[model samples]
Structure formats: C-alpha cells, structure tokens
Target chain A: MKYIKVAGVVVFLLLWQLAGQINPGIYSSPTLVVTEIVRLFTEGGLLGLVFGTVATMLLGWAFAAVIGVFTGFLIGRYRLASLVLEPYLVALYSVPLIAVVPLLVIWFGIGQTFLLATIVVATGIMLVFPTAAGTRETVRVYDQVARAYCVSGRHFLFKVLLPGALPFIATGMRISVQRALMAVIVGQFLVGHPGLGTLLSDARVRLDADEVFAVALVALAVGAALTALVGWADRTLSAWRPEVTS
Target chain B: MTLAHGKTAAPTRLAALTGPGPVRDWTIRVAAFCALLLAWQLAAQNVSVAVLPTPRRVWEGMAGLLERGDLQLAWGQTAVQVAAGMLLSAVFGVVLGVLIGWFKPVDDAISPLLNAVFLMPRIALVPLIALWFGLQDTAKIALILSFSFFEIFFTVRNGVKTIENEFVEVAKAYCIPQWTVLRKVVLPAITPYVMTGLRLGLVYALVGVVLGGFFLESNGIGGLIYALGSDFRTAELIAALFTVMLVGLAVNLGLHRLENLLAPWKVTR
Candidate 1:
C-alpha cells in the first residue's frame, strides 16, 4: 500500500509534467507550482491572506457550532416546534448559502464581515439538522432513565442529554467545517476580497495556472489538517462513551 | 355511483384543507412567513432601500424578472448543467466506487489519491478548468461533475463495504453468476447510498455550476446574481436568491420522492 501510494504520486507528477511540457502556457508543472508556492510565501501576502481566511473560517465555525447546537437542541426537545419549523429549516438547509452571496454583499458590504456572516449562515444551517436529529435520538434513548430518576429538567438536559448528544453535535460540526471553508472562499471570490480566494481569482485572471495550483495546494493542506483534527476529536470523544456508561 | 363518490370526495378534500393537522401547520408556517415579511418591510423603511429592499419591492423585482423571462432562462440553463453534470457523476462515481470497493488491490492503489483529491477545495479548481474550457457551459458542467463525483464515490464505496459477505456467499453457493450476484444483491444493497449520494450530488452540482457561473462569468443564475450584486439591485438580487432557494427546496423534495420510489422498503430520513 505504501509503495502503491508512492508510485501513484510519482505517476501523477510525471503525467502532469508531461502535460505541462506539451502545453507550456496552459498547464503548470509540479515544479512550477512548487516554486510559485515558495514565491508566494516569500514575496506575496500569503501569510496575511492565510491568516485572514483561517481566522474568518474559525470564527464563523465557532459561531455556527454554538447557534446550531442550541437551536437544534430546542427543536429536538419540542416535537411540535420541530414539526412547525421543519419546512422553513429544510428550505434554508437545501439552498446552498453561497446562492445568497448577493444578499450578503448587499446587507453587509464586501468585507470580512460579509465573509464571516456568509460562513455563519451557510454553515450554521447545515449543522442544525444533524445536531437536532442526534439530540432527538439521544434523548429518546435516555427518556426512560431520566423519567425513572425523576431528574429535574435542567439536570436532565445538562447531565444526560447534552453529553449524549455531544458526539452527534461533533459530527455535525465536522461536516460544517468543510462547508464553512467553502462558503468563506466563495464569498471572497465573489467579493474579490483578500484571502486565498482573491489570490486564486487574481492568478486565474493573469492566466497563471501555477499560482492557482499553488494556492489550491495550500487550501488542500488546510482542509486536510482541519479534517485530521476533526477525526482526532471524534475518536477522543467516542472514547468517552465507555466512561459515560460506567 | 361516480357522481355520489365525486360529491363525497370533493367535500372531504375541502375538509382536508380545513382540517387541523395540515391546516394548522400551514397556518403557522404562513404566519411565520408573514411575520418575516412584516419585519423585513419595517426594517426596510428604516434602512436604505439600496441595502435592504422591502418585501413588496423584492416581490416586484421577482415579478419583473419573471415577466422579462430572465429568471426562467437563467434557471433553465442552470438546471440543464446540473442535470448533465449529476448524470455523469452518478455513472462514473458508481462504477469507480464499486470497482474500488470490491477489489482490495484497486482500493489500495486508488484510495490515497482519491482522498487527496477529495480534501482539496474543489471550488478553487474552477480557474484551472476555465483555463482549459473557457467560460462556457462545458467548463461549468465539467466543474459541477468534478464537485459531485467524489461525494457519490465515497458514499457508494462505504455502502459497498457494509454489504454483508454472507449474501454474496449464499448467491455463489446457489450457483449465481458473478454479474447476477452483483446486479441482484450488491445493487439493491447500495441503492440507499446511491440515493443519498444523488441528493448530496444535487446540492454540490448546483454549487459547482453556480460557482463556475460566478467565477467564469457565464449566463446562468450565478451570472444574474453577479450582475445584480454589481448593479446594487438589492431587491432583484433578493428575488433571484428567493428563486434559487425555491429551486433548492423543489429539488430536495423531488429527490426524496425519487429515493422513496427507488427503495420503497427503506425509509429515508
């Protein structure tokens, strides 16, 4: 498997280099993209852009997690409220929040505020259903135990429901992170704001495919790191399952 | 008998409309919607119309776009791209997914590369594609295909992995042909996963098409959105957004129906 992966990488790079050789201007070789990555870090505003993008994404993701989990909990707790709001929530969820970029731009202007808000709205809604469903399932599973113990409402929620639903909420948060990043980038692309998104837009306009790929490589790194972090968190949280039961 | 039945059915239909279950739910929904509209109208009165238009104004803007046929044309173009892209993704994803899922060597060879590609922000690759195909429908469609294919691939692959080996063993013991086993057992087992992929594929397909439209500056709803954004036509922009949301809802409901139709035994949530 290791050899297979290495061989796969080598073949991909060779094919790419070959393509670049055949069409020098149209495609960029791995070497060129690597150099571009170096140039970007040394000469371009790569650090600042990365910081800006990551900061916005993290902030938006944090806000989404809070709001989504809370709202989802309430919806889960109240069956009637869930039923009443199902249509609206589904409509909100179904629409790619990117589709409403124009509204964000109009309301918030083309800035970090716009990007952050867009990420929050877009990713927050995506998190809600998963969280709510997870909470509902967890609560349903524990309802009898809570009733037998005659746990107070607040105690039942905090002691029983929240911990039980944590895994589901985490799962939802994991899904939302990818989407939040997408929303942030798309907002930047649309607004022509500062970030990797703007860098991508500028590179494409210059027909500098190398730079585009270079920035994409950075994005891939960030995405992979975030996904890894989420995976680690998931494993760690699930470890708590045995502890909770005991 | 026909006339009697018609009369009874008509009254029951009317009663259903006025009944508590759907009727009360719909009433609350409409009230919520109206409350939202009222809030927006009030807020619009205080704020700059350019920034936040009144609900009435937005409705007019939508009506204008509908009358001018821009909304329909743009929506039609977007729908066509989404449909084409989704079809390609479904075909390729299912085939590749099944191949990799079934064969260990194939999976070992491909999973690493697929994982890397999947992690990359696909939207960022739009420019590279534009460099190849220009800002045309082909480029848009290709982007959508790339966006959607991996999602289906992963879902189908996982689904395949979870299929019980005993079923395949039993089929083999019964002297079932390899192809027959695949068609009868594997396909049915993975139908739910395929349906899920299809649903996610629909949303991602739209994302790809719209992102392409925004970046490539093509003639679709994204183009209309970009145009509206630039012109600062807030009302029309909101209207266009409303239309997109409606399309999203319609597609979602339609896909759910499709899922139920395809796999009647399993309930899809």
Candidate 2:
C-alpha cells in the first residue's frame, strides 16, 4: 500500500507526459517542469525569488512573534486587558487577509520593498490574540514565587512567564507563519514584486504552464520547508504537550 | 455581537476567579484607533482632499455614493457573489471531506496527493481556472473550490478518523442504521471540526474568489478594487478596501458567534 501510494505520483507524472505528447498546449510534462526547475536553479533567479518572499515572511513573522508574545504576556498577566483586547483580536483575525493587500499597496507603493511592508501589515496583527491569550493563561503562582524572591523584570520574563507560556507562543507562531507566508504570496501576486511570486506571475503572463508549475513546485517546497522547520522547532523546544498545545 | 464597552469591566470582578495582572492592562481597548481618527480630523484641517483626503471627506464620499445609490448596488452585488461562493464551498468542502474521511481506502489513495497539491497556493491554479471557466463568476467558484476543498477535507478527515472506536461499537451493537449513525453520532461528534473547517476554509474561499475577481473582471469588490487601485486613485482604493474589510469583518464576527453557539467547548482552539 505504501509502494502503491508512491506509485500514484509516478503514474501521475507518466500520464502527464503522455497527455503533453497528445496535446502539448495545455498539459505540461513532469520532465519539462523538472528540467525547468533545474534550469531555474542554475540561473540563480529562482533562488533570489524564493529568498525575497521568504525574507518578507520571516520579518513579518518575527514582528508578529515579538508583539504577540508581549501582548500575550500582558493579557495573561491581567484579566481586564485580556477581556477587552481578545474580542477585537478575534474579530480582526477572522477577516480575509487578501482584502487588505490593496489598502497596503495604496499606503505603500507597488513593487520593490513596499511589498515586504505590505506583507507585514497583512500578517502582523494575527499574532497578537494567541500570544496575549497565552500570556494571560500562564500560571500566576510562578509569578508570585518569583516576586517573593524579588525577581527582576528580565529574569521573571525569561524564567517564569516566557518558559511557562512557550507552548502558547509556539502554537501562535505556527499559525502566524502559515498566514504570513500566504500574505506574502498574495501581496506579491497582486501587488507584483521580484520573487517567486513574480516569477509565477511571469509564467502566467507568458502562458507558460510548465514554467508556472515549476515555479509553483518551488513555492510549495518553500512553504512546506517553512512549515516543517518551525513545526519541528516548536515540537523540539516543547518535547511535550505542556510547552506547545495542539 | 454587541459586546459593548461595559462588558470589559468584568475583569475587576473576575479577579476572584483568577490571579495575576495581565502584562498590558489598559483603560481603553481601541484608544489607538480613536487617537488616529482624532489625528486624522485634525490633520484634515490643513490637508487637501486630492492628496490625503480627510476622514470627513472619505465619510462624505461614502455618504454621497450611498445617496447616489451606486455604493448600495455595488455592495449588494459584491455581497451576493461572496455569499454564494462561500455557500458553495462549504457544501462541497464538507461533502468531499466527509467522503474521504468516512472511507479509509479513499483517504489512503488521496491524502498524500492532496497534501502535495495544497502546498501549491490556490493562486497557483487561478490561471488554470481562468482558462477553463473564463472571465466569469464560474472562475471565481472554481477558485473557491480549489482554495477551500483541501483544508476542509484535511480537518474533517482528521476529525472523523480520530474518534474513539467504543462509540462506533456501541452504535453497531444498538443496530443504529448506518445513515442514522452517521447523522446522529458521527456528524454531531465531528461538528467541532466541521465548524472550525468552515470558519477557516471560508476565509480561503473568500480570498480566492476576490483575488480571482481582480483578473476576471467581475462586478465584485475585487474587480472594483483592481480597477481603482491600478489607476492610482488611492482614495477610491481606500474606500473599496474599507468596504471589503467591513464585509470580511462582519462575516468573521458572525462565524465566531456561530462557532461559540455550536461548539462552546472549543473556545481556545
């Protein structure tokens, strides 16, 4: 059954090639996409494209993490603030991320570095709710014990709340990373920029289905790698459910 | 829906319920927003409408458009498109997801395929849909299907597959009809996952439809936004964005309420 499952993909590619031979205009062969992927790699253009978008996503994710953790800590620490802020965060997080791309593009210009900023704006707000909730929900006794020893702000943050709330931060971060990546892609897709998104856009404009598929494969690899990387980190750091809740 | 400012006062009382002060407690939840509005009003006194249009000017623009009946018509048209697309995705996504979940053979055959395909953003398939369906509402629907089908399927499949076997055995012992067992037991039990799937998947569908519309020339907000934004009419783009955000916010808030009612046990998740 495992072998059969792997064969499904191979069979799919073989069939795709056959389809291309029958009608080259619509279906692109896996061989061609693979060859294109190799070509894209050697040319170094694809690397830049992947990096550009990845950089933006990482920046936004970093921003979201810092702000989200701070807010989460605050919310976890105080009951009133959590109640007040949670509603708005939940309300805002539900909105479709794409709707803001245009406004972001308007505020920032189209193309170049503005696209990064646009991606940040689109995904930054998402981190606030989860982290704040994580913070608010952290155990108070840890804080009390720390206070009894006159724990410094930095010490208390690093020793008590941060470690205790690591699981929440990890979960929130995992959620935000996917969203931030999606926002970056969409921002680049619509707003147009120099990256894998732009490469994909170029493929579309030229109607190079094979090139588009190849570029998409690269993006998929990037997306999957990002997910797996952060996910592994989260799981490793926690090593148990107590650190990162599913 | 109306969780008014007064409800925020519960923290002082709920202190008996819990411990510790939240890290960033504040008097106002949206003070930054209010501050910005006030700043905008003050800045508008010196700014030109053509440049940085005042909040008042924007409000006037919104009012005038509504008064002229164009805004209402546009909103109505866009709302219908979004609603219809969302409904279609929800129905198809759930059905497809449930089928794959309920049947292990199908899940075995299709899960990896889907995992690979979903990694490629739905926007990757927009051109394929456009070529197949052309610049029509159908393209948007196709895009919606592509965006939504995978997420809902994954969630639902995981949901149903993860259930305890004891309940199924109990149902079998009682000789519950297969369909009744599905409806009465399976559906209710997986309702939490389905609700989560719907809530999340609809966002994907909404974005796919709207983004696809930018290139498809539909009469929806996406089309209007693309038209206006591409023209460098910042103010109009801002207006269109506000309208889009308003609708999105409304849908999300509405879903949160529905989720709370349907699955109160899943507040944190």
Candidate 3:
C-alpha cells in the first residue's frame, strides 16, 4: 500500500511535469517552481512575508481561542445566558465570515488591523460552536458527579468541566487552524497586504505561473506544519482519553 | 453544530424566562433585542458615525435597499451560487468518498492525494482561479465547490471507515449483494456524518461564494459590501452584513429542520 501510494504520487508529478512542458506558457513544472522558491527565499523577502502572515494568523488565533473558550464555557455553565444569547450567536456563527471582511477593511483600513480582525472573527466564530457544544456535553456528563462530590463552582468548572471539554476544544482549535489560515490569506489577498497572499496575487497578475506555484508551495508547507502542530497538541492534551491506551 | 441547537431552544428559553406563554416570551425577546439596540446606540455615540453607525441608521439603510430592490438582487445572486455550489459538492463528494472507501485499492491510490490537497490552503488559489475563470459566476461557483467538496469528502470517508467489518461480513453471510449492502448499510450508516459534513460545507460554501463575489466585483451581497466599503457608507455596509447574517441563519435553520425531518433519530442537541 505504501509503495502504491508513493508510486501514485510519482506518477502524478510526472504527468504534471509533462503537462507543463507541453504548455509552458500556461502551466509550470516542478523544477521551475523550485527555482522560483529558492529565488524568492534568497532575494525576494519571502521569509518576512511568510512570517508576517503567520504572525497575524497566530495572533488572531490566540484571541479567538481565549474569547471563544471563555464565552463557550459561560454559555455551557449558565443555561439562562445560553438561552438569551443563542439566537445571536447562531446568526453570527452561521454568517459567511468572509463576507464581513470588507466591512472590517472599511472599518480598520486595509492593513494588519483589517487582516487581524478578519482572521479573528472568522476563526473565533468557527471555534465557538465546537467548544460550546463540548462544554455543554461536559456539563451534562459531570453535573451529577460534581453534585455528588459537593464540589464548589470554581472547582467543578476548572477540574471537572474544563478538563472534560479539553479534547473537544482541541478539536475545535484544530479545525480552526485551517480556517484561520485561509481567512488571513484571503484577508491579505483582498486588501493587497504584504504577505504570501499578496505574493500569490502579484504572480497571478504577472501571469507568472512558476511564481504562483512557488508561493503556493510555501503556503502548503506552512499549512501542513500548522496542521501537524495542532495534531500534536490534540494528542498531548488528550493523553487521558480512553482512546490513548498506547 | 451546537449553534444550530441554540436556534431551536431560543423560543423555549424566552418562555421559560417569562412563565410559559407565547406572548410573554415574545415580549421578553423583543425587550432583549431592544436592549441590544440601545447598547449599540450608546456605543455608536463614542465613535464617529461613519465608523460605527447607530443601529437605527443601519436599519434605515437596510430598509432603503429593500425598498429600492437592490438588496433582493444582490442576495438572490449570492444565494443561488451558494445553494448550487453546495448541492453539487454534497452529491459529488459523497459519491467519490464512498467509492474511495469501499475499495481498498482506490483508497490507497487517492487518500494520499486528498490529504496533500486538503492540507494546502485553498485561498491562495483564488487569484489563479480568477485569472483562469475571469471574474465570472463560474469562478464564484468553483470557489464554493472546491471548499465544500473536500469537507464533505473527508467526513463521508471517515463515516465509511467507521463501519465495522463484522457488519459487512454479516451482510455478506446473509447473501447481500454489494450494491444492496452499500444502499442499505453504508448509506444509512453515513447519513448523520454526511449531514454534519453538509452543514460545515454549507458554511464554507457561503464564505467562498461571498469572497468570490468580492473578488469578481459581481452584484452580490459581497459586492454590495465592497461598494459600500469603498464609498465609506458604513451604515449601508453594516446593513448588508446583517442581511448576509440573516441569509446564513435562515439556511442553517432550514437545513437543521430538513435533517430532523429526514432522520428523526439523528436529532443532535
């Protein structure tokens, strides 16, 4: 199976290279993309652009995590609060967050401010649903346990509820990683900010297929790395989970 | 998912707060909404009216657009693209996912490619898509389709994987045909998972379609937002955004209702 997978990728790459060779103007080969990537790194400030995007993405994610987890916890704990806020929350959560980016761009003026706010709102709203649902489940499961033990509210919240919901929060965070990244990139793309998205868009304008592929490769690498990091966090955080017997 | 749960409970909560009567619940909910508007009005005072418009002004802007029929035109364009793209992906994604999962060789060949594509940020490809498709409805639909497809595909694949080997063996022992097993067992088993995927996909599709509108400079809610933003019409921008939110909430609620009707046993809180 592993060999088949490896061979499949190799065949795919070969076909792509062949297609590029046949239509060099429209398509770009792997070799050309590699050359462009190396050039971008050495001469084109690619690292800075990458870090700029990543930094903004991480910052937005941090804010989203804090706000989402806190609000979700509150909603889970106080059914009354959940009742009052649920409709608005659902409306906000369901809204195509990308649709709101222009408003942020208008409000924050097409720079890091717009980018960060867009990233935060997009990722934060996505994070809220899972975390809140997980928290609700935790509350349901642990209510009797906490009552039987006569645990204090704080104690029940921190020790029983939060821990029980950690796996769910982690899952939510993991899902949001991809979304936050996309939001930031699209935010930059729309606003013409100086990031990987800008680089990609610039290349598109110049009709530089190789340059586009180069920037995309970097994005792919970063995306894969972030996903791995989230997966690692999920595993470490969920060590107490029954599925982790190993 | 939980957001959808909140929508249904909202009416009941209002009743619970005001003692079991529809009128009382309606009054309480209206009061809460009024309080929110009042808070917004107060907050708007602190900022430039151009920066954060008062709720009243935003409502008026929405009302004006509605009266002029512009809001309907923009909303209809976006709605059509989102609905079409999501439906197409839902069908194609489930079929492809099932095919890949039901056959080991297919899975081995395709899983690696899917993983690679899935890990890559798709927003980076938007410009390329625009360049290729030229700022048209095709580009908008393509963007929505691309995002929705992978979401549904991955979820359905996982659903298929969850089917224990024993169940398949039992079916085979009872002389069940492959297609019949797939229809009776696999389809039913994956219904809930597919619905979950479809919900998430719907969200992504909406985002993609809206962004595509902004990118393509089309006559959609996103385009209206872009125009409002450029013109510094903050109130109108906010109004358009509110419209988008309403459309999203309505679609989400409708899907939730449909899911409940289709599989009553799978009703999730």
Name the lDDT value of residue B180 in candidate 3.
Answer: 95
List the lowest-lDDT window of 10 residues for candidate 1 chain A: A237-246
Give stretches of model 1 more than 4 Å off.
Answer: A141-157, A242-246, B1-27, B164-166, B174-177, B267-269
Q: List the residue pairs that clash in candidate 3.
A: none
The CA lDDT of each predicted structure is: 0.82, 0.70, 0.81
Candidate 1 lDDT, B1-269, residue by residue in tens: 45555564444655655665667667777887788778888989998889888988999999999999989999999988888889999999999888788776778777888898798788878778777777788888889988999989998888777774757778878999877877889988889888988887887888787787788856789888878887889889989988888877888789888888887776433
Q: Output the number of the TM-score-best candidate.
A: 1
Residue runs of model 2 more than 4 Å from their true location after superposition: A78-87, A139-141, A240-243, B1-36, B43-52, B68-70, B164-166, B173-180, B259-268
Fnat for every candidate: 0.65, 0.39, 0.67
Worst 10 residues of 1 chain B by lDDT: B2-11
Q: A70-189 in candidate 1: lDDT tens per residue?
A: 888878888667866777787798876687787788789887788888888888886777778778887878999889989858998889888888877777877777788888888888
DockQ of each: 0.56, 0.41, 0.63
TM-score of each: 0.89, 0.85, 0.87
Model 3, B3-91: lDDT tens per residue? Answer: 65557545566555566455665665678888998899999999998899998899899899899988898888888888888888999
Worst 10 residues of 2 chain B by lDDT: B16-25
